[model samples]
Target chain A: MLRVLIFSIFASSAAFAAESGGMPQLDPNSWVPQIFWLIITFGGLYIVISKIVFPRLSESIEQRNDYVSDLVDEAKTLAEQTEKLNNEYKELISNSKKEAQEIITNGRKKLNAEFDKKKNELDKNISELTEKAEKEIQSFKSNSIKDVQTIASQVSGELLKELSLNDEIDQNIIIKKIEDISKKKMGELN
Target chain B: MANPMNQFEVKTIGPKIEIGNFDISFSNASLFMVITVATISLLFIFATKKKSLVPSRLQLLAEMAYEFVAKMISETAGSKARPYFPFILTLFLFVLFCNMIGMIPYSFTVTSHIIVTFALAIFIFIGVTIIGFVKHGFGYLKLFVPSGVPVVLLPIIVVIEVISYLSRPVSLSVRLFANMMAGHTMMKVFGGFVISLGLVGGWLPLGFSVALTGLEILVAFLQAYVFAILTCIYLNDALNLHH
Candidate 1:
């Protein structure tokens, strides 16, 4: 195949170049030192990495992870506390609202009872005053009627004397006569 | 034109040291390896020094690398592979830094060499095998005998499976080494063209070199990812014995 040919050509050229200036890699003399140094260096590196480097890196990484997780846990607890406080605040607000509503209704009921009692008291006082005024007016009318009757009697007697018709005029007779006459007139008018 | 291969050459630095028969002298490769190790160690150490709840940029970088490998292992090999996080992270960071550092002009790529990658890969392969055996005992051999094959084809299938299993290290190491080496070599080759062609005519190769540099950077990250993921996959095979 063309691929094989190309590879052989490349290999031959590499060999020719190798033969021209001996490949240092093929020199057995150098291998000892290279291998020796390689063991020392590689072994030293392995120890350093395994013992020193790995533990340090792992510790730091583990520490970071632990710190981050602790922070997250604290944040979660804090969030829960906030939610609890918010719920408590809402409950307090609702409780105060309910108490305020009860207070307002109780105050209105007390005011209404006082208002009704005062209205009843005012109605009674007004009725008592009107009844007293009516009684006073009735007594004054009776007394005035008595005074008018007496005056009528006196007037009749005087008029009889002045007229010179009858010298013996009895006041009671005159008064009775006047009263009967007036009664008859008043009855007739009624 | 400068030999692009010279960039990979190992040069001794300071006094040479020998232990027994081996020439274990400190070289540029060794220096860079130390750099790679020290770079990761210091960066990570500094990043986590504060251990602040909120990570700084450097800390974020370190965490990202850690999480990246952790996620890769968990996804590929399951949570049972959690213990291997440090090893996989080290491997990934080491390879990634080597490739990235190599991207700088005139710097050496430690992983571009076969022996280095091979060593790492062979180590991983052996470690994974040991884990599989430890975890499953003799039952780990069931990995070579997949399920739902015809009895007649079982022999062929088992042989193929065994070969592929054994080739894991070679393939794993070569894939990273070849990619790094080829990309660097290609960039070097194009860079040579830029100089030989002179100012007016060299713009084309210069543009290609620039583009190839970007691709190589991507390849650098990608190869590291592949190397890590492949290790996770092999670990998965060992841990779970996937059909």
Candidate 2:
């Protein structure tokens, strides 16, 4: 029933359109409605779109732009932080290497100083021992010379007593001469 | 055979009301225009309702359309034309929908009417002229007077420029009204042939009708785009007054 009613309306209007001449759009009778509706529709749309629709759409676009910019800013900050951390890590490694190098050099210097001190002490001790042995030899040589001279004097006196008179003068002289010769020999040996 | 011109006729559709002598009555043109408005409103409302950073397909399409008009106006008229962005968009969509709707079987195209298109054109003409006058005062008359012209040719050139300027609305309105009316009439004529020829003979006319319909749809979009762009150009002249 609805379809029939709709078709009938379409048919009747279609007939009217067919009967019109030249151009039906020019008919003075229709101008009023066209103008009327155009104003209503155009005016309404202009207001709604300008005031409501356009603003909202532009706002959404603006929001998207802001979101993108924010993301870019965050990425840039992250990159900068990464670069800083990388530099810091490198710095730390270099600093530790410098410290280790300093420690090794310092230990070497201390060991060299201790070794030099011990070597110097050993050299001083060796020199002192040699001096003491030389001094002892000098004293022993003097004492042996004295004993030899006394032995020579006693032997000469005993020989003279067994032989004849006048032995004192000759024995004394011989003992003196032997003492001089012993002294000369001891000096040559020293 | 049925008259091809018959499709352009306007008939009252609802209860008719009067204001004194003026006939302000509801008609099919009004009906379709109302539908266009509702469709535009709803489409925009839904398109913006989400307002997601990542737009949906619907939102993207809607944004493209909105930006198309916005960009056209900005490029043509510069920032001075910002005020008329909504008006220009409304005009474009209204003509576009009317043309598309007219393509529907058993539907009326509101833009097919001369008074309708003429009224729109004339309104634009007057508004642009007023803006030109208001912005530049009497200086706008300089638009017709080309610089560095020989004194002998100045008067003649001015007259031609004035005539062309006066003809803007006529040319603008006629371009749209004539295109729609002619295409529809041709389609109707072919459609009549299809019926009269019957079966085997009708096949040829039916094919022509199909081709014509496709052509008409293209013409519809082009005409609307042309109308809106021209309007932006005119607005540019008024706001900027390059000459």
Candidate 3:
């Protein structure tokens, strides 16, 4: 099929050349320069485009896309880190608050215990002082009673010697002496 | 009286240069090819100088041309070959503009010539071949042999594949040259009829000329599209090496 087609083209060219009065029209040589020139031109153009122009364009596009993606990833990472740090800070704050509360509660308990201990010691000291005062009062009363008895006995002996001379005066003297003795004992006890 | 075929004549300028056995002449055809290149370059430069989001008229046209070629390449060759969109777009625009510009009052259609179209086709052929080799190296040769072919028919299939590969350029070139030449020749012949018939009877051929002119315009665009699309297909084969 292809041979037939090629043959017809060459044949047509031949016929055209023949009809044109052997003027060397549509000659193969006429087309040779054009063919060679075309090959050279296209070859040079393709090389320049493939090697230089296309590579530059493609690289620029790829670089732009990569830069954009990198920026997005960086933003995402920063956001995640920020969230993590915020959570950590919140946890620290909550823990500190709980610790502070616990310390305050423990301090109040210690103060209350110390206050109760001081109150118990003051009560015991007051009781011991009152008991000592009672003992001293009892000793003073006993000494006064002995002194009063001796004095009374001396006075009675002198009075009895006088009464022997006056027997009738003894009854009135005894009664007066008894009354004075009772009064002395009551004053000493008070 | 104007001749219809007169437009196609190769007019020599100054003196012909002879190099050894070859006698090469620079004619109106070559001159117009250079003009075509310059015109296309200027058109693109001027149109695309301020490529706006909301395009101006010229920018709109330029963008439309770009979009047309881009879509064609993507649709025909797939997304992997989308990188070649610029080259293919430039080829399409240059060819399209040249063909359309030739339809002007007194202009030469460079694409009508086999040498010009063949140059383009052969360039694509060489480029595709180089790509296949560069990508797959010696393995590129495997493209010629089918995998599922029976042992008995292997020789025949291989021969067919080789022939097909070799004929790619010829088919690619001939398809463009033939279409442009045939359509322009028909337009010229019809134009001759309109001129030969004087004012009273001329209206009939004049009307035919108008319709033929519109048809020629469509053919011009169609030829460019066909040439570019085929180039994409060839490039696909080079890239994928599909059977």
Q: Quick one: best TM-score, which candidate?
A: 1
lDDT of 3 by residue, A1-190 (tens): 5346435544554455456543232555545444443344345444543454334333443555587899999999999999999999999999999999999999999988888888889888888888888888888778777767765776567557666787677677777866776566556656
Model 2 TM-score is: 0.73
**Model number 1 iRMSD:** 1.9
Query: Over 4 Å off in model 2, which ranges?
Result: A1-20, A79-190
lDDT by residue (A25-58, candidate 2, tens digit) is 6578888878988898889988888888888878
lDDT by residue (tens digit), candidate 1, B137-240: 99999999989899999999999999999999999999999888878877877899899999989999999889888888999999999999999999999899
Residue-level lDDT tens digits of model 1 in A63-159: 9889999999999999999999999999999999999999999999999999999999999999999899889888878866876676666656665
How does residue B7 of candidate 3 score in lDDT?
Answer: 62
In candidate 1, stretches whose alpha carbon ends up further than 4 angstroms from where it belongs are A1-22, A126-190, B14-17, B145-157, B241-243
Cα lDDT for residue B104, model 2? 95
Each candidate's TM vs. the true structure? 0.81, 0.73, 0.57
**Deviation in Å, model 1, residue A77 alpha carbon:** 2.1
Clashing pairs in 2: A17-B6
Clashes of 1: 0
lDDT per residue as tens, model 2, B18-60? 7887788988888888888888888888888899888999899
At residue B213, what lDDT does model 2 achieve?
90
Measured against the true two-chain complex, the DockQ scores of the candidates, in the order shown, are 0.43, 0.29, 0.04
Model 2 error, position A166 (Å): 44
* Cα lDDT listed for each candidate: 0.88, 0.84, 0.70
The regions of model 3 sitting more than 4 angstroms off are: A1-190, B1-4, B14-26, B199-201
